[model samples]
Target: MEVRHKQATIDKLTHENATLKRLKFAAGREHFNAEQRRLLEDTLDADLQAVAWWC
Candidate 1:
């Protein structure tokens, strides 16, 4: 893959990882409703699909 493409992908994945982590932490603290937690987990798993190797 092209370096630019890879870099961009990595950057996007990093941003998403940060967002999901924040969501997970907030959810763990009971900030998210049950439905919200389910959605967050699903989205987080989907986001991880972009960089499964890194994980």
Candidate 2:
């Protein structure tokens, strides 16, 4: 039982680490120029604000 619990914990942590790595890769700015990145950020900010306001 103890071994199963530890293995479960390790598996969960490994999955979380892999998810974080994928998110980090996707969020990297290397694919965008500065202007494009700025535009995307501005659009995202506006969308977030709209969501907040709706909420």
Candidate 3:
């Protein structure tokens, strides 16, 4: 891929990661339960890993 395209992909994934972090934090506010929060966090982590591998 072109350098510009690669950079854009990286930026987009970074944005997604930030968004997921926000979502996880927002979810944490109400349901402080262990399982739910852990799942959300795990999802976010998987997303981040996928992005990293893709880039």
Where does candidate 2 stray beyond 4 Å? Answer: 29-55
Q: All candidates' TM-scores?
A: 0.64, 0.49, 0.52
Off by over 4 Å in 1: 24-30, 53-55
**Model 2 error, position 16 (Å):** 0.2
RMSD of each: 3.1, 11.0, 3.4
lDDT per model vs. reference = 0.76, 0.63, 0.76
lDDT of 1 by residue, 1-55 (tens): 5887788777988888789678768665757778977897798777777577544
lDDT of 2 by residue, 1-55 (tens): 8788677666655665575466469776446668976886686566556544543
Off by over 4 Å in 3: 1-15, 21-29
| Tens-digit lDDT string for candidate 3 (1-55) | 5898789777878788687767768775756578876887797788777777876
Error of 2 at 23 (Å): 0.6
